[model samples]
Target: MDNTFDKKHGHELLKKPQFFFGMLLIMSLLGYVVAKGGVVSGIGILAMPIVISYVYLIFAIPNTGIIGIYILNFVAIGIVRYVKGVPLGLTIDAQFLLIYLALFFKTFFHKIPWANAKNDLVLLAAIWYGYALVQLVNPEAASRIAWFYAMRSVSLYMLFTVPLIFILFHKKKDLELLFKIWAILSILATIKGIAQKMFGVDAFEQAWLDAGNASTHLLFGKLRVFSFYSDAGQFGAAQGHAGVVFILLALSQKRSRRLKIFYIIAGVLGLYGLMISGTRGAIAVPVMGFALYTVLQKKTKLVLMGAIMGISVLVFFKYTTIAQGNPTVRRMRTAFDPNNPSLQVRLANQRKLKSYLASRPLGGGIGSAGNWGLRFTPHTFLANTATDSWYVMIWAEQGVIGLWLHLFILFYILTKSVYMIMFKLKDEEIKGMLSPLVCGFFGIMAASYGNGVLGQMPTGLLIYSSMGYLFLGTKLEKENLAIKAKEQLELAQCNK
Candidate 1:
């Protein structure tokens, strides 16, 4: 009777066979593939580990919050251009949306703090986004889909990403982490650009140039060494921005020696990248940023130094023949010459656009200008005219009303940030961190006068994140000091 019972139980267990069919299905498919193509099967077998790792990363990244989002952002800005057939870097759009969803879902599962959500900076961003929404009914708009694509960089990313930064990244270490990532990636970009300059463009990049990009990319028999950015203009301006930020951070007396060294190296590499990009307008970024920094100091010594430097640069460009032999210097010198043919052309185009858009308060629709305009409505008036500056693009799309609002918002944030840095912040390290970010924003804003770099990837992302951090400046300093005080108190108690 016991043997019978045991045999019945064993039979029941066999009936439930867990792995048999699953293993058989997998093995059968593998076997069939191996039989069909042995080497191809082996290749797929080798790729299995990588596929598994990618799957793990996809699931794990959501836990990282803003860090993961920034990592994806870096990839989007620094790597996506090299990837073929991506159609305006769709991966960036998908990843940004995915991260937003992840953060949204995480809020339900975990207790995430809403830090500085009600701040003026964040409120301004909301207004900007709402204004973008209002543009959908723009009567001049040719395609709604075009507006969807064009508006993402203009306002959507800035709208959501800024608040996310505040909520997710609260610690001082978070600021350090962002700067380090920025510096390292910029260094890598410089290296790649150096390779392009010294050797030649890679196969993918060459192919990109071949695909009608050669007209603009290859100027006067010289390549513009864009690295992996969207274009040389973007690359150069971003590099210049990085150079200015890192250089200031390097010069900060409060930073550690190792950190200072790292910043210096990053700054040098960044400047090199800027030089190779052959973008003349990039010079304005650092000059304007540093000049503002000096003024913000409110010291006579710094003021005089900054004035001298500014005057020196002007004189060098205007009067001196020094460094004119250098191709980079030569290109940049043209920026100071009002008589430059390119400058004249740009001015002429702007005048024409002004005349045409004078009567229309809303101007051309968002997608009715620039590359979007050319792609969607090639024969349109705005399509032919060049809205080279970031402000110009805003004017073309949103008209003077929107332009003034944007400017007002920028000036408000900038003034508030300067006040916080100069008066409100007490901690030196915290002040140091915020200073570079604020100054960098100013640099980018000034640079935007030359190119439509402000509303683009990486820069747009950086600007919004900087604003969030600047708004949280006092909070961050207080939290850091409290932590320090607590540690010191604990130490004293232990001694007693």
Candidate 2:
């Protein structure tokens, strides 16, 4: 009876053979891997726990994953400079996959409001991605890898980004946050460019210049100022796009004085970055963006003022010798010249491409014309044909059909956005915020006519994000009205 008063508990792990032996086997295998592969494998093993937490974080806070994507879009290409052979791109793909996995797990407790993503923007992205996918079997395709690389920016990112934004990040605060993030990054980029301009290139940047980039980045003994971006052309265009959006933002606001100052400073920095980049086409970003922005304003007097300002800029560049001593202005001034050597070169390339693509309506393939073309299929006709313009690259790779479809999608989006901004939306603040995005988009489209920045990093993702937010403008306006109504009712009741 006394012996029955006490009981003994066995070790739980010892009781379960699977649990005991499984961990032992895993440890043994991991030890073998670390012994064979050395420190790198051990580092990876140590990092596994951290990687596993990605799902927890993503599901817990949806926008964390989304913002990660934004950060990746900015920094992905820059990784190539440091990590030589390893594909840093895998990180992006892995991040996207983890995001989707997190979203999947979230379905156990909550429904992802699919209807919010059911819009023309998402549909258009899908259609474009579908088109890119079809190129996998194109007869003219010489490199499947190139198609894989090209389509991600050309369509896949748009497809992935648009729906995620609609479903998760569609609020007004999300937009404000996005703008702030964009402005901060743009400002940082300018500062970096300024650093490079004043202090000279670092070892990595110098190495980059040594590897054929010197020809472009170091033009005629002068630095073209690529900053930290993939190239000067991209740096210039991205800055120009940001510059216009922020400057326009400052102009549109009246009450938000601090915000206005922030916008102005960011805008000015972006313009300075663009100038130092020495990419002639970047000037068109502000020119075309402001043109569209003035129209979006829908006030006759403001429109007239915008026109006057535009004409003044055009005249200043075209007619006057103002600031000819300044390298940036002198470089930008050439963009207005029809007979400029660079313009002539571009024209010649287009003509050659026209003849080559005469028989093949789909052009060469998804990645047959741009930087990827040079990498994957350098011997191909499309690869050798310098596709200076983003639209031209699309045409050279995806053909006339792709170009027309792309144009239609872009124009349709702009038209719809304009209509909503002018008549449907009532909130001045929301409308004003959206105006720069719309204008920036138009500006980028215009810039794409001269540089392949449209489908490039930072710009493509930014534009896709902007498009998604622009479509949600009406919803944001509704929320603003509801909040305002609540505030007014509370005020009246308090007075009573």
Candidate 3:
């Protein structure tokens, strides 16, 4: 009987390792399949079964509630592509889907101590909803489409992504990992942009541009490099934002010499990539972001000095047209030219929007105005007209009330973040890290004056995600301070 019991225990112990090995093998195979790049059809075929199994598993193991949903989104995307009879880029899509899924699962399983709705994001959401509500009352106006666009582009995407970011990214290590991924992606984009600039538009980009009916010629016949993003505008803005963040972060880090060198190289390369994108509006983003940082630091003298230099540069560019001599500079100068056809058109559109807005204060319903609106909700008011500026789009769609809410949210967030950086956060490294984020926010706000940047994919993602980080960092800083105070008090009592 003793021999039989010992044998049974040995068998059970052996089975445990086998089960572990099998699970690892399955996970490894899934990763390999994803890396190899053709899981769409397979996912589609297994979608129904996977969904059923996932639902059952979720009920059996509540911790895995989000896994099934993540899988479902990819499967749905695949099924949509299959029905449309379009050849999809499964590799890129799959990678994004996996990242999204991982974030979702992390949020579902782990309770993020820092996650809360007390920051600027909450205000932003409120503004979005307020504007959306306004649109519901007056769906017939042309500006109404802008509201619809906001719903699809800004509101929905943020709702899906920011929560995941807040939950999954709690520690400094997580932030580092995120930055690493961002750096790698930025490098890839820079290389692609350089390639496109050096060699004319490739077959892939050409096909995409043709499909989208966008102009291929950019920067005096030099092809504007878009890489994998939606347009040159987005690519430039993303690169510019990345460049500023990298530079600021590098300056802030207390790292080894080699890592510092790498950061400098990355920053320069990212800036070069931004230049190649030929997006004039993007150039302003970094400057604005940096200015915000300086202001928050209470460097009034520095701010004044920078403003003088900036004005001088603008004057030189405006009067002498020195920028016109250089291809890249010339495009940048175009943004300042009031006579430029695009600017004139945008202004004319704004005038029309203002007249429409004056009549219907509440404005049009949500999902009524821009390209996103037309795609997501076809029956809204402002769906056809191009609402170029983010602020303008908000006003046209959601009216004054919506705009106020949106502004209020941004204002609240900025105030809170600045407060944390100034008072609560004691670490120099942490303060430095937050500088760029603050600056980026300012830059986006400035750029939004000319461009409807609030709804763009990568930019929107960065802004919302950064807000989460800012909130989390503040909470962590406060907690750390409290712990330190407690320790100090205990030590003092013991000494007495």
State which candidate has the highest lDDT.
Answer: 2
Model 1 Cα lDDT, one tens digit per residue, 25-90: 888988888788675566667778974665456445653545655666655644434543334355
lDDT of predicted model 2: 0.87
Ranking by lDDT: 2, 1, 3
The candidate with the higher lDDT, 1 or 3, is 1
- Per-candidate clashes come to 0, 0, 17
Please report, in order, the local distance difference test score of every candidate based on alpha carbons: 0.81, 0.87, 0.65
lDDT (tens digit, per residue) of candidate 3 on 128-220: 655555455674544444544347555655554555455445556556665666666677778877877787676545655666535533544
Q: Sort the predicted structures by TM-score, highest score first.
A: 2, 1, 3
Instruction: Mark the regions of model 2 whose C-alpha exceeds 4 Å error after superposition.
Output: 1-50, 493-496
User: Which stretches in model 1 have alpha-carbon errors above 4 Å?
Assistant: 1-65, 77-82, 253-255, 490-496
Model 3 accuracy (lDDT, Cα): 0.65
Which candidate achieves the best TM-score against the true structure? Answer: 2
Q: How much does candidate 3 score in TM-score?
A: 0.72
When superposed on Cα atoms, how far off is each prediction in RMSD? 4.8, 4.1, 8.2
